[model samples]
Target: MLSGIRIVEICGIGPGPFCAMHLADLGADVIAVEREAAAGAPSSLLNRGKRSIVADLKTPEGRELVLKLIEDADALIEGMRPGVMERLGLGPAECAARNPRLVYGRMTGWGQTGPLAQAAGHDNNYIATSGALYYNGTPAEPPQSAITLIGDIGGGALYLAVGLLAGILKARETGQGTVVDASIVDGSAHMMQLILASRQKGLVTGPRGENMHERSHFFATYRCADGHFITLGSLEPQFYALLLEKLGLRDDPRFAGKQWDRARWGEMQAHFTELFASRTRDEWSALLEGTDVCFGPVLSPPEAAAHPHMAARDIYFERDGLLQTRPAPRFDGQAVTPRPLPQRGEHTGAILAALDAQAASVWG
Candidate 1:
């Protein structure tokens, strides 16, 4: 869908590379810029489909080269703190001045103008400020440090990509560009939109794990006899009834007429704990494979790859003896093929040649 779009990715860690990867996957012509020494290593799975070039932005000549590339680019993406780009003489103002149609995207943990914009932080710090950390983990324990997936990839990369695409489209129409300030903390807070609405309407409780979805026996994870876990998400009454029937607890008087009654929640949870522990996870999975009971066995990464449904969907693929996930949402009746990731600066000469060709034509 992004066939003719051109993206210049300033190499950094985490979310910036991920956002560029998504653009490349969607058929964008993405060129990644890395420091010279950072090249020559094996490419990472996330760097697939991108051509790489080495440019030391600290040097006047290298910074000038980057400016030249930006002049012809549809979009430029960077993951750096607020003033870092300005200090390096490659901030949005400089880039946008050279190319009025450039969509300049900045990705950071805090927003560009916030008090904490210049502070050092990571995914955990960002999610903590957004209230996302508060709802994580068990009811009795402190909020657990979550996997970086939510804050870094979900809130940071995905939102930055969306913002960049939107800005590019607008620039195409208006003949002017805009800057996208995509902050992980802001994005994480935005992700809690639905939960905030629920809280405002008095439907959600003040404390963690006291809410219906968080605390209810019908919508949580339970341990099985083998210490493996299963998750149940029977949110509706019909689904809840199906889960009870599948677990052979339909006729149990302790669970009768008190499904959502908060007063009886403790008793109901205890009953569910004991009942779920009676069977192994595999045994439970076999019994509830295709039912509307809304049941699934908790699977680790390797186990998820071998799952029958995942295999059928071709969710994971192996490339050059490396195991990696395929790009999401098949398109145009064509399965997205996995391209081998590129080593840093592998395409530097080719990219420079193309740029020189364009410059010669313009000069002529």
Candidate 2:
């Protein structure tokens, strides 16, 4: 979908490369600039589908090469501290001077103008401040954090990708560029809108794991006879009825009609825990996997890759001795075949030659 769009990515860790990977998956021509010393280093899966070039941005000549690429590119993505890019002479103003239509995507943990913008932080710190990590787990447990999912991937990478694309669209229409401040703190807070609304409506109450969906028996994971886990999400009335019937508890007074009764949740959870443990996960899956009871067996990564449903969709595959994910949000049933990850600075000579030719055409 982005076949002809050219992007210059100033390589960094985590969210920056992930954003560039998304653009590249959508068919953008992305050139990743790497440090000369690490030019031949092994790249990660996030750098797949990008062409690499070696350059020391600390040097004038190397910085000039990147500036020249920006002059002819539609966008640039960089993840750096607030003033880091400016110090390197590749900040928004400098790049915009060369290409007014370029979208400058700035990815950072705290955003460009906040009080914490200059402070160093990681995914956990960002999500904590944004309220994304304050309400998980049980009330007794400290709010747990996943491995960079909420703040880094969901907040930082995904938002940066959207900002870059939206900026690109506006630039194309008006011939004017935009500086996208795609920050983890900002994005994470924005994603909490639904939860905040729920709180205001009194749909959820208190701190930590007080919400019905988090603690209730009908909406949580349960252990089985084999020690494996399964999940249930029978929140609606009809689904709740199905769940009771499937578990042979339709006639039991405790579970027959009290799904929304908050006071009886502990009792309900105990009942579910005991009942679900009567059978193995596989046995429960056989009885309720595809029904309106909203049940599913919890599978690990390798097991999930081999599940019939995931296999049918070809969601995971083995390539180049690595288990890789297919490009997401397929275009009309067509997914981008993920290319092999490029070695750092693999295309330096070829890219420089192309740049030379373009320069000659303009000034010769």
Candidate 3:
């Protein structure tokens, strides 16, 4: 869908590269500018489908080379500390000067302006500060989040991608540029709006696991006989009824008609815990895998890849001995086939040749 768009990504770790990879998957011509020293480093899945060029940004000529590239690019993205891009002379203002229609995207854990803006932090630190981590884990334990998934990928990269696309749209119509400051803290906090909105219904009250989502027996994870886990999300009335029927508890006084009796939830959950442990995960799956029970066994990445539905859809595949998932949000009922990962600086010669520029002119 982004066939004609061009994105210039200043090479950085984590969400910045992920965003560029996503755009490239959507048919954008993405050029990743790598530091000269990183020419022969280990391969990164984040570099998939992107062309690579190496340069030393510290030199005036190197910065000028990128600025010239930006002059013809639709968007430029960089993940650096608050003032690093400005110091390197590749900040939004400079890029916009060269191309007034550019969308300059900045990604960070904290924002470009904040108390901890210049401090070193990562995914966990950002989400923890955003209050999105408050309800995670049990009430008895400190919050623990999935590494990098919530903050970096969900909050940072996804938001940056949306912001860049939106800015590009506006720039094309208005003949003006935009600077998108996509901070993980801000995006993660914003992502909590759904749970926060539950507060209006008195569902998100109390502390931690005391809330509706974490406290209910029907909406939690259970460990089975084989030490594997399964999840249940029988939230609606009909689904809860079907779950009780499948477990042969439909006529039991404790659960027959008391799905919302908060007073009995602890007792119900304890009973469920002991009952689910009597069978292996697959055994339980056999009894209730596809119905209104809203059930699923917990699966690792490889197991998920081999699952019937996922395999039927061809969602995951192996490449270079590494597990990888296909590009998401398919268009016109088709999944995007990912291109091969480019070797570091593999396109340097051709890219420079296209510009009619020499390496020494930029490297010096």
Candidate 4:
């Protein structure tokens, strides 16, 4: 969908390349600038669908090469610490001077102007500081998050991609460029608004485990006979009723009370734990998988990739001796075929020659 849009990505780690990859998957022409020393380095899955060039940003000539690319580009993405790009003479102001309508996207953990902006940090630190991590795990344990998903991919990369696109839209309309400060801290906090709204409604009151989402047996994970896990989200009254009916517990006095009865949750949970353990995950799936029980088996990566629904949708595939996912938010009711991973600096000479040719034509 972004077929003609050109983006210049200053290669960094994590979210920056990920955002560029999403754009590339949508058909953007993304040129990833790498360090000269990184030439022929092992390619990353994130480098898929992107062309690569190597230059030393510390040198004047190297910085100029990137600037030249920016001259006709729609956006520039950088994930450096605040002021690092400025020091390299390739910051927003310089790039905007070359292409007035460029969208400058800055991805970082702490954002551009906060006290912690210049401080070094990572995915976990950003979400922790944002208060989004407070309610992740069980109350008995320290809050644990899935690695890099919440803060890095969801908050950091996804937010930056949206910001860059929005900025590109605005620039196209007004012919004026803007800088997008896409910070994981800010984005993760913003993502907490749903839970915060529930809190305001008193549905999420009390201590961590005592909250409605946590305190109920109807909204938790249970272990089966085979030691595999399954989840239940029978939050609504009818769904809870269906779950009890499926388990042959509809008439049992222990589970017959209000679904949110905090006083009975411990006893109810104990009963459920014993009951679910009577059957293996597959057995339970046979009984309740498609009803109003709001049930799902907790699957590992490979298990999920091979599941019936996932395989039917072709969501995951093996490519280049690695597992890869198709581009998301699919268009035209079709999955976007992932492009090949580019070898590091594979297009450096060809890209430079194109630049030289463009300059020659302009001068002629």
Candidate 5:
């Protein structure tokens, strides 16, 4: 739906590229600016479909080139830490001075004006400070990181993409641009609102494994006979009944109408541990794959790419000899596949020539 929008991304390591990739897939024209060294690297799936430009942000000419690109862009995204852009002369104030309608997007681990804004950190540190990491693992262990998904991709990339798009809309309507401070810490904290509410209402509580969402027999993972694991989340009453019937436990006196008996959860889970182990992952999946029991097999990345569902929908594809995911959140059941990844500075001359041609035409 975002067909004609234009985005210029000052490429960084993680979230910035991901956010730009999402935009490009949604039909936006995305240009990626990279350092000279980075531009020379081998094909990365992250740089797919972007017109890659190699520029030295530290050099005056390079900085000026980026400034010129920003002049006509609907939005500009950057993931540098606090004061880094200002030092490079590409900060929000200067960019806004050039084009008042430009949406300036700033991405960071900590927010632009926080105590840790200037501190060096990563996704783990941001989620750690946001109280998000505390609820992940068993209480016996320190909080698990969830491997940067919760902070870097979910909190950082997704939020920046949403903020930039929203700001672009407002700018187009009122000709008044805005700055989006898309901080991973802030987004991670915001993400906890739902769980925080659940905790307040006593629906979700205790240390990690003691909560209903975690420890309950109907909402846990079980090991199969083959040593692989399968997960279950038969939360609703009908689904719970179905699971019990499928497990041949409906007639067992131990589970007769004991769904919410929290005191019996451990016993129930123990029973499940023994029972599910009787069958292999394939066996259990064959019995309850597409049912209302809310089940999915734990799959590695390659396995997931080869899954039947993935193959049917083309969720993953090959481009330039690299495996990459298709654009997500389709529009009217349609999403665009990104073009091939650009080589180092592949479109530098073309982009510069196009800009000069447009400039000359307007002036002449």
Candidate 6:
């Protein structure tokens, strides 16, 4: 969908490269800039489908080369603290001045103008500020960080890609460029909209694990006889009834009424704990897979890769002896082929050759 678009990615950890990968997957011409010292480093899955070039922005010539690439590009994505780009002489203002139609995207943990914009932080810190961390984990335990997936990939990379595409559409229409400030904190907070609504409606409870979905037996994970886990999400009455029937739980009066009542939650959970322990995870999966019982076995990474549904969907791909997920949403009736992750600065010569040709054409 993004054919003919040219994007320059200033390489960083986590989200920036991920956003660039998405663009490249959609057929955009993406060039990733890596530091000379970092050349020949290990390949990263997030940097797939991109040509890489080595440039030390600290040098005047290197900085000039990046500016030239910006002039010929449609967009630039960078993940850096507020003033870091400005200090390096490649901030949004500098880039946009070179190409008025450029969509300059900045990805940061905090917003560009916030008090914590210049502070050092990571995904855990960002999600903590957004109340997302509060709602994660079991009701009895302190909130566990859900890895970098939520704040970095979900918030930063996905939101930045959306913002960049929106900006690109507007720039195409107006012939004017803009800056996209995509903050992980803001995006994470935005992701909690449903929880906020539940709270406002007085349907949610305090103290973390007491909520209907978080603490309730009907919507949580349970251990089976083999010590493997299974998840349940039978929120509706019909599905709940189906789950009860599947587990032979109809005789229990404790789960009979007021599914959302906190007073009976403990009793319901205990009843479920006993029921789930009678069977293994595989047995439970067999009983629940085709029904509306909202059940699934808890799968580890390797197990997930080999899951029947995942295999049918072609979700995982092996390239260059490395396993990674394929680009999402099959396009044009064709699956996006997985490309091997690039070694740092792998395509420097080819990318610079193309840039040199463009420069020579302009001079002529």
Off by over 4 Å in 4: none
Candidate 6 residues 282-359, lDDT tens each? 998888986898888998877888989888887887777777888876877677885556778878788778878988
* TM-score list, all predictions: 0.96, 0.96, 0.96, 0.97, 0.95, 0.95
RMSD, one per candidate, in order = 1.6, 1.5, 2.8, 1.3, 1.7, 1.7
lDDT of 5: 0.87
Any runs in candidate 1 off by more than 4 Å, and if so which?
200-203, 332-334
Tens-digit lDDT string for candidate 4 (1-364): 9989999999999999999999999999999998777435798899899998989899999999999999989999999999999999988888888989999999999999968888999899999999888877665678888899999998999999999999999999999989999999999999999988989987888877787666578888889999999999998899999998898889987787667778888888888889899999999888988888999999998998998989999999998679888999887789889789988899999999999999999999
For residues 29-104, write the lDDT of model 2, one tens digit per residue: 9999987764356787888999988888999998899999999899999998988889999899999999999999
lDDT of each: 0.86, 0.89, 0.91, 0.91, 0.87, 0.86
Which digits, one per residue and each the tens of the lDDT, describe model 5 over residues 1-364? Answer: 7788889999888988889988887788889998787535774577787888888999999898998898889999999988999999999999999899999999899989967889999889999998888777654567779787999998999999999999998999999899999999889999999999999988787867678866789987889999988999998899999999988989888897998899998899899999999999989989988999888788777777898987788888775566778888977887567777888788889988988997898899
Q: After superposition, how far is residue 61 of candidate 1 from its true place, in Å?
A: 2.0
Model 3 Cα lDDT, one tens digit per residue, 48-115: 99999889999997898899788779999999999999999898888888899999999999999978
Comparing 3 and 5 on lDDT, the stronger one: 3
Best by TM-score: 4
In angstroms, give how far residue 2 of model 3 lies from its true place: 0.5
Clash statistics: count for each candidate: 0, 1, 0, 0, 0, 1
Lowest lDDT sum, 10 consecutive residues, model 4, at 34-43
